[model samples]
Target: MATNPPSIFSDSRRKANRLRTLSLQAGISAPARFVLDDMVDDMAERLAFVRHEPEKVLVIGDYTGRMADEVLPHTASINAADLVGKHAIDLSRPFPVTGFDFVGVLGLLDTVNDLPGALIHLRQALAPGGMVIAMFAGSGSLPALRKAIYAAEPDRPAARMHPLVDTRAAAELLQRAGWKDPVVDSHDLTVRYRSMDRLIADLREQGLGNVLASPAPPLTRVGLDRARQAFMAEADEDGRVTETFSILTLSGRRSLAGT
Candidate 1:
C-alpha cells in the first residue's frame, strides 16, 4: 500500500492565525472582501442548477460568516465553520459535523497539506448522494509577483508560493478519493495594481499569503527595491500592472450505492 506523504504546511495553528488575521482585516477593505463574495456567488449559481436544494449544508472557510445569508433562503439549515471565526472549525483534520446533504468549501483547500485525505473526510461526512463543492486559488496565479520575486534575487530565489493544483490534477485527486460524478473546472480573474506593495497587502487581507513549511526570509531593502522596479516595468498605459488568478472549482458527490 502507498502511504500518504507528510504535511508540507507550517502548522495548523499558524494557518489558523493567518486566516483569523485576514478575516479581521477583511471587514475594513473591499479588495479583501471580493474573493469571499466571489466564491459564494459562484457557489450560489451552481447550487441553483441542482434538481433539489440541499437541506443540511456545511460551509467551510466561511470567511465572512455571511454564506448562510445567501444559502439559508434555499437550505433548511446552514452551518458555517472556519479556523477562527464565529462558526469556528479547523479544516486541517476531520470535520466536526457529518452527514450533511451538501458541503461548500471556499478558499480552504489551497492550504491543506493532505488534499486527498481531506477529500476522504469530506466524503465520509456527506450523506449518500450528497455533494461537495470546493474552490481555491489554482495553478498559474500571481505571475507578476512571481516574476518580480525572481528578478529581485538573480542568483538564488527562495520558495515563496504554495504549490497550486491544476484542473486535471484536481479532478484526478477527486476520483482517487472516491468521489462520485466528479467535476473540475477553472476560470481566471485579473486585477490591475499600481504597486507590488498594494498587491501584497490585498493578498494578506484575503488570507492568500504564503503558508509553506519553510517560507523564505523577509526580503532585504535592495531586493524590495529591485522587486518593485520589476513589478512596475510591467505596467500598462494607466501605470497599473495586471495580475491574474486562476480560480479552480471542483464538484463531487458521494456514491448512492453504499456508505
Candidate 2:
C-alpha cells in the first residue's frame, strides 16, 4: 500500500549492470564476488524449508541473477525467476507475481525507508502457502567501533555503521506485514583490523558506508585523528581493532488462507 519513487541503485537494470561490471573487475579473484556468494548460500539454506518445489521464484534484493544462476545449475524445479535488484523497501512496482513457491530477500530490510510496507507487498505477491526468507544487519553490530567513536565524541549520536534491524522489531514487522509462522534468528561475526583505516577501506569496498538520515557531517581531519587514537587505545593485546557484525535472519510463510 505504500509507494515511492524508485532509487537509481535499486533499479534492476542498473543493479545488474553494476554487478556485471564488478564481476569483470574482480575477474576470477575479485573479493567483492565473495559477498555475493555468501548471500546466495544464505538464500539456498532458507529455501530448503519450503514444502513445495518452486516453479517460479522471486528474489527481492542484491543477489538477483547471481543467485538464480548458482541455484539453477543444481536444481531443476526452478523454471521461472524474477529479480527486483533494489532496496526491498522501495520496489518500483508491485511484484507481479502470485503463488510463487519461494521469495528470498537478503540484506535489504535495513536500507529501505518503509520496512512494513515492503513486507506487506511481498506477502501480497506470494501465492497461498508461499515462503519468504530475509536477512539484515542487527543493532549489536559494530560495538567496538561504536564505543571508540562515542568516546571520541560523546555528544554525537551513535552511528549505525550498518543499518541494523532489531530481532524483535523484525519479527513484529513480519507479522504486521501479514506473514504467518514467522521465525527469526541472529548471529554475530567479529572481524579484526590492524587500524581504523583498514576498517574504513573494508566498509567502502563493501558499499556499507554511512547513508543514514541526517547523518553527521563528514569526518573532519581532527575528528579522524581522535577516532584513530581512540581505536588504537581500545585495540586488543595483538594490536588489532575488532568490529562486530550481527546478522539477523528471518523466515515466514503466508497462510493458505488469510485470517
Candidate 3:
C-alpha cells in the first residue's frame, strides 16, 4: 500500500492565486517582478560561471518566462512553465518527464507540503551529472509584514504567512535526497514601501501572495487601518518602511553513475 503525503496547502487555491497573479501582471503597465528577475539573473550567472552548457533544460515556476528566453539561444531545447499547460503538473508528485541535463526551480517550492519528496523528485528527473538549482523566500524573510499583520489582530493573530524553510533545513534535505556536493546560499532584498497596500500589491505581482490551505479571512476596515499604521511605525524620514526579502538558493548535482 502506498501512503500519500500530508496536504499542507490547498492545491486549488495555489492554482487560482498563480493564475490571478499572471493576469494582474499582464494588465499592469510595469509589474513588480523583482523576485522573478532575481531568479533569472541567478540562473544566467551560474550558467556562465560553470562553463557547462546543457543540451536540455527544464524550468518550473518561472512567472516571467524570462528563463526560457534567456537560455533558449544557448541550449538545444528548453521547457519552461508557470504551472499552466495542456495537462496540469503537481510538483509534489513525480514529474511527467525526466532526463533533463539541468533543472531550475523558482518560487514554487516554498509552499509545497512535501518539500522533501519534491526535492527527491527533482533529483530523479535529472540525468546523471545533471544539475538542479532552486530558489525561494526563506525563514528570515518579511519580518515587517509579519509584525504588521500580527498587530492587526492583537488578541488572536491568524495564520497570515506560510511556513518558510531555512538554509540549514534545506541543506539537510538535499543531503537526505542524496544530492552530490549540495550547496545552499541566501541573500536579502530590501524594498522600501510607502504603504502596506503597495507591499501587498507588489507581492501579488510577483506571485508571492497567500497560498495557505486555510487562509485568514479578509481584514476588517478597522483591522486594515491598524495594520497600515503598524507598518508605518518603522518608517524612515521619507515615510517609507524598509522590508527584507531573504532569498535562499539550493544547488546540487546527481551522481554521474545515475544512482
Candidate 4:
C-alpha cells in the first residue's frame, strides 16, 4: 500500500507558483501555448472514443483547466463532472472516489515518484468497466535540451525531467492496477522556439519546470552562456530550435465485477 505524504497538494501548488513566476520573467508567448492547445485537442478526441460516458470523471494533473474544458463539450450528453474542480489531486494519497465511469490522467504519470501505487489507486476508484486514459512524457522527450545540458557541463548530467513511462512499462502498470485490455501508444510533437530562453519560459508557464527531487545547482554564468550557445547551434536557418515532446497515451478498463 502507498502512504500519502502530508501536504502533497501544497507542495505541487508551490512548485506551480514558482514556475509561473519564472515564466513571467522569461516572457513566454503564443507559440508555446499553441503547442499545448493542440495536445489538449488530441486528448479530447481520444477521450470521446471511450465507450462509457462517466457521470463523474476525474482528470488527474488537470493543470490550467485546459483539458477539462476540451473534454466537457465532448462529454456534455453524459453530464460528466470534474472531481478535482480546477485543482490537482494528491496522487500519493488515495483518491476518494467510487463509481466513476472514466478517469483521464494527462501528463501526470511520468513525473509521479510512485507510479505503480498511483495506478493502483486509480484502478480501485473506477466503476465497473470504467476506462482510464493516461498520458505521460516518454523517454524521447527533450533530446536537444538533454544534449545541450550535457555538453555544457560534462561533470553534471541534467536532472531526470520525468520518470518517463515507456509503453511496455505503462502497460504493466495498468495490469498491476487490475485493469483489463490495457492499451498503450505514443505520439510526438515538435515545438519550435525562437530562443532557448523562450523555450524555458514556456516550460515554466506550463508548469513543467525542473522539480527534480535533487536538482543540479543553479547554472553558473559560464554554464548559462555555454548552454545558450549550444541551444543556438541547434537552431535552424529560421532562427528556431525544436523541442520534442513524446507523449505516451495509455488506456485500460476495470473488470465489471472483480478485485
Candidate 3 — what's its lDDT? 0.87
For residues 40-79, write the lDDT of model 1, one tens digit per residue.
Answer: 8888888888754888988887656766875545536887
Q: Cα deviation in Å at residue 7, candidate 3?
A: 2.2
The most accurate candidate by TM-score is 3
Comparing 1 with 4 on TM-score, the higher-scoring candidate is 1
lDDT comparison, 1 vs 3, better candidate = 3
What would the per-residue lDDT of candidate 3 be over residues 55-134, giving only the tens digit for each residue?
Answer: 88888888677877765455458877566655456787788899999989988899888899989999998999999989
RMSD of each: 2.0, 4.8, 1.6, 4.3
lDDT of each candidate versus the true structure = 0.82, 0.63, 0.87, 0.67
Query: By TM-score, highest first, what's the ranking?
Result: 3, 1, 4, 2
Model 4 lDDT tens row, 18-109: 44643454574442454345556777787666544566677665444676665654553332232233343666567765666777775655
User: What's model 4's overall lDDT?
Assistant: 0.67
| Higher-ranked by TM-score: 1 or 2 | 1
Tell me the TM-score of model 3. Answer: 0.95
Please, what is the TM-score per model? 0.92, 0.76, 0.95, 0.81
Candidates by lDDT, descending order: 3, 1, 4, 2
Model 1 residue 71 distance off true place after TM-score fit, in angstroms = 3.2
